[model samples]
Each structure stands twice: as structure tokens, then as C-alpha cells.
Target: MVKQWWAALIAASSVLAGGEWQNCFNGKNLNGWTVKVTGFETGQNPGNLFRVENGLLTVSYSDFPNNSFKDEFGHIFINRPFTNYHFKCEYRFLGDQFPGGPKWAHTNSGVMLSGQAPETMEKEQKFPTSLEFQFLAQNESGTRTTGSICTPGTYVDVNGKTIKQHVIKSRGTALPAGEWVQAEAIFKNGKVSHIINGKTVIEYSNPKFDDGTPLTYGWISLQAESHPIQFRNIQIKELD
Candidate 1:
């Protein structure tokens, strides 16, 4: 009887440990999502930048100069909001660039958290006031890596080191510019752990970039910058 009890306890613990993660995007359609954006006129506008086909969430910019973000600026925020969770997604660079935009907009994409409502943004606003997990592809020399964090209204500490800067560039292996990379972010309390390709590139705590005004929770958003990017396998698991 004692042995059976112990076995049962272990099994239960294992199941609980594995049940913390949940899939946010169904890899099929934009069923559980809402979009807020100003735009041009087309089937591939900013509100429609994210699309699902063959179980992949593809972020394309081929119609940029034609349909999306041509004269309007906006963000497409996720319909749901989360506080403490583990968010994971797979992304890839499509190696397509635009003729005109900011210098960094060539291969720029990001996951915005703790962000404001998309409809509430200013007409000419550049970016939302939130914590941004910056995604960069190889510019010229392939120097950039994954797992970098850009704090718009937040900061974080790691191992007693409180970062006061805006960008915490991760020191991980450089992902190939045109390949798929697995990105993971562990959020709990006010801390974050940035993982890329199954490797932990950066860990931060107590995030607050707004001059000590810490943000505990907000919405999640994906970037539709003037570049071609693709994402899939988006899922999250709530934490206790």
C-alpha cells in the first residue's frame, strides 16, 4: 500500500508539471483574435497581416507598399490578455525587404507584451508603450542573435544586476537569417526569461521601465513591421 501511494503521487506530480502550457493559436485561423488598425485598402492590410495557412501563421510584407502600413500606422493586438505565463512560438525570416522605411525595419519583428489597446494608439505613434521582445535578423555581418529584450515601459534585473538601459541584447547563438527559430519567454511575477532555440539567452527580474512604475500584466501583440516574417506554433501556459 505504501509503494502504491508513492507511485501515484509521483504520477500526479508529473502530470501537473506538464499541464501548465496551453496553445493560444490553433494554427488554423484567426478565430479567437481581434484586430485594430488604420490602413490602406486591400485583402492584406495591417489588420490582416497575420494569416493562417497549412497550420502556419505567416506574416508577410509583400503587399506592404500596396496595402498595409502604406500611409496608416497601427498594431494588431491579441484578443486575450495574460499575466503570468510561458509563451512560446516558432518564427522565421522570409528574406524579403522593402524599398523604403527605417533602417532597422528591414528584418525587424517583435512580440509586444504589457501593451495598450491597439485602438487607443495615436495616429502617428511609432510603437506602443510596452515591453518588447525584439526579433532581428542578420543585417549585414550576421552579428545579431535571438532572445533580446527591449523595454519600452519596463526594466528587469538579473542576478542582482538591475538593467537601466532600454535594450537587453541577449548573448546567444546567432540564428540563421532565413531559417526558423524557436523562441520562448517565461513570465512570472515581474520577471522574464528569454529562451531561443531551446537555450536560455537572458533572464531578468522585476521589470519596470516607466521610472519605477512596474507593469504586472497586459495584452500580447505581434509586429507587422515593413518586413516579411513568419510565425507559427504559438502557445502559452499559465502559471500559479
Candidate 2:
């Protein structure tokens, strides 16, 4: 059933918005983005954690003093928010995990969806109130799958049941590190879906805040958890 949805969506991937896809990252710089890392004010990029390198928007830890990441979870958000759209990107995990980060964050990063504005987050807020389209790669411990959904401060109904758990694994492909994988999300008309490498892994609907308000739209951001990762070819297309 999910495969059927994937086939339909990817078929429409090329020609959405009149055969035009909006390039989110200009590849030269982070001009249309905002940085919000915990323990730092908005726009203050500590340790040069997020930067443009080799024409890719990268997350690295090469500049941290004393090899400490300082647990400053970070995110770079597009300045403009979206309501209904298709977002796609290619991501890959890189070298070692920085010190001072939790084990769970190793090779772990995510794309924040329906998120609050960068400026609205607290100085020490761990994560924004949003739905996270999670990404994971293999580590020494074991193999992990990508495309799982994590709800930081929201809820959704999956398979006709309300799911309140924090993170739910998807029936996604398990690939190793160092390989670039395609990740995507579709949030249209109060329905949500996650796709990985052209496979539809999870689907849900009725996203609502803890306060019972329907969450139809918000900002989108890429995560900078405690790992070395790079993102490229980030693009989005609005659905009507």
C-alpha cells in the first residue's frame, strides 16, 4: 500500500509547480536561512558548526575547541515557512561523532517540520515544538533505518490510531554510512507522509499541537545534532 503511494508521489515529483522546483540552498552560502543553536542566541553560529563547503551546506565539528561539541544542538531554518509542499534533499553522514554528545545522537540528524520560527525558540530550548523527519545511518552498535518520525511536542494519527510516542521507526531501508540517501516529506491538506530513497515508509494524518490546535503549517528546518553530516540539492515544490 505504501509503495503505491510512493509511485504516485515520485511520478509527480518532477513536474510540480509547473515543472519548477524551488532551490532552498543557494550552494554558495546560507543567505536565506537562520541558525538557532541551543545555548546561543539566534544567528550566532558557535564553533562555525554550520557552514557552506564545497558547494554543500555542511554540519561539521572541526572547529570546536578541545574537541567538545558542548551539547549545543543546532538547526538552520529557511526564513520562509510553508503550508503545503514537497521537500527533498540528499544527505550523508560523515566522520566521527564529537565529544560531549549523547550516544543516541551519533550519526543522527533530522529535518524539522511544522516548526516554530527560529527567533521564537528559547535560549536553552532543547528542540523546537515540531515534527521531526528523522535520519539515521549505521554506527558500530548496529544498523539503523532512516525515515522514522519523531514528534517533539506534537501528536499524529498513524494507521487510524493516535500515536503519542516520541519516535516511531519506519519500514525504511537500512543503508550504511558514507552513502548519500534521498529524504523527503509531504505535508498536504493535514496529511503527512515520509519517503526515503523513493520508498514510502510512513503515513499519518491529523497533526495537532498539545493544546488541541490543528497544525497545518509552520517553518521547516534542518537539524544539526551531534554528528557530522552534509546536505545538498535541497529543493521544495508547493502543491497548488
Candidate 3:
């Protein structure tokens, strides 16, 4: 009876350990990711652009010097490629400004999906040729809202209606600045979904770019576009 109980306990532990919420970021190093761009470089060991703290993977921009901006476009992309999966993360607006930064940088950041080769992007290119799950904060113009889709080279449709504009129509009420929000993207069977705080903010299908080409799979990346943003709880589960 004692041996049987021990075996049962081990089986249960293994099942729990193999469940969802697997840590993508190693937390101690950039082992599973690749960085591409000029003017910017990874930070100190174990605690850099992507760090693990208190069981959370934090993408921080605080360690770099204030004058670090020298047109240094940087991206930390997942080394592994994914085709159909559900990705989710928790993000917070740092509200910190950099010297000589763009005026709207405070409300700017995004997650690039179906992304291009990081090395293929030209040195002067500002963004990747992929679909962007744009994360925005409340701004003076009121155009920056969370859960909006921005197609760099792709477009989405709603209810069979093609979206002519680059930006999608906002789904829920705008979230105030300086708060953490949960964001999720479901990519399966040539469809995608953008969800915010448990609410389906945007749902569209048949994502393709301006050239009328379909995106089957690509790397996932996070942007540090002249603004301070932090992301945690980054995880992805593969789909059949």
C-alpha cells in the first residue's frame, strides 16, 4: 500500500508539471530567443531586456542609459517558430519617458506575429513585415486603445467584411493609462483572435498582407519601440 501511494503521488506531480503555463523565457539568459537590430544590445547577464524575477519573465528597459537611443531599433524574437497556437501575456505601461524620444512613445508597443526573419529586416527598417497585436494606452487623441490589430503586411476581416484600414476597429472601452492588462491571441485554422482582460476585443479571420499572400507560420517578437513597457507571464500552447 505504501509503494502504491508513492507511485500515485509521482504520477500526479508529473501531470501537474506537464500542464500549461510553461516558461518560454529562461529567466537567467536569452537562451530561447534571438535579438536583432542596431544601436541596442542585450543588458547585463541574468537581468537584461528579458529577465526572470519572482517567477515572472519581465521585459524591462530601465537599465539602459537615458541617452541610449541612437536610432537603435531592437527586437527579442522567439528562436522557435510556431504555426497554430494560443499566446498570452500580461503587460503594464511603465509611463517612463526617454530623452529625445518620440512624443507618443509612452503609449506605443506591440507583439509581432507571423514575423519575418529578424536578420532579413534592413538596418533602417522600423517594423517587421508581420501582423502586430498593438498595445496602446490612452492618449490625448484617443486613438491609442488596447487590443487593436495593426497589419504591417497583413489584413483581417470581420463577418466577411474586409478591413481596408491598417488599424482595426476598437472592440471594448479604452483602458486608462498606467494599468496592467491581460492580452491573448488565438491563432488556429487560419483565424486569429485578440482578447483583452477576458473579453474578446477583436476577432477576425483569413489574415493576409497587402501582397495578397497568406502567413502560415513565423517567429514571435516583442517591440521596444521608443517606449518603456514590461511584459510578464508569457506562454504559448500548441494547437492541433
Candidate closest to the true structure, highest lDDT = 2
Candidate ranking under TM-score, highest first, comes to: 2, 1, 3
lDDT of each: 0.67, 0.84, 0.67
lDDT of 1 by residue, 1-240 (tens): 111122333343333323466776877887666554444322224535567757887675554445424534335566656667788888887756654546667677878876655544555565666778778777668788667888765667878888778888888756666788888888888888888888888887887646575666666777767676778888878785
lDDT of 3 by residue, 1-240 (tens): 111222333343332222355566754656777776454433222125555556555545566554555555467787656667788887776656545556655657778886776655666666777778888877777655677888876677777887858778557555666688888888887888888899988888887756666665666888776666677777888674
Q: For candidate 2, which ten residues in a row score worst on lDDT?
A: 1-10
**Poorly placed runs, candidate 1 (over 4 Å):** 1-19, 37-47, 65-74, 209-211
- For candidate 1, the C-alpha RMSD (Å) to the true structure equals 10.2
Q: After superposing candidate 2, which stretches have Cα over 4 Å from the reference?
A: 1-19, 140-143
Task: Give the per-residue Cα lDDT of candidate 2 at 187.
Answer: 90
lDDT of 1 at 233: 80
* Candidates, ranked, lDDT: 2, 3, 1
Looking at model 1, report the run of 10 residues with the lowest lDDT sum. Answer: 1-10
What does candidate 2 score on TM?
0.90
Off by over 4 Å in 3: 1-21, 38-71, 140-143
Candidate 2 local lDDT, 1-240, one digit each (tens): 111122333443444342358899999999999999999899988878899999999998788554676668999998767778899999999888888889889889989997777877889987877899999997565657789999987889999899999998888865787899999999999898899999999999998776666776677899998889999999998875
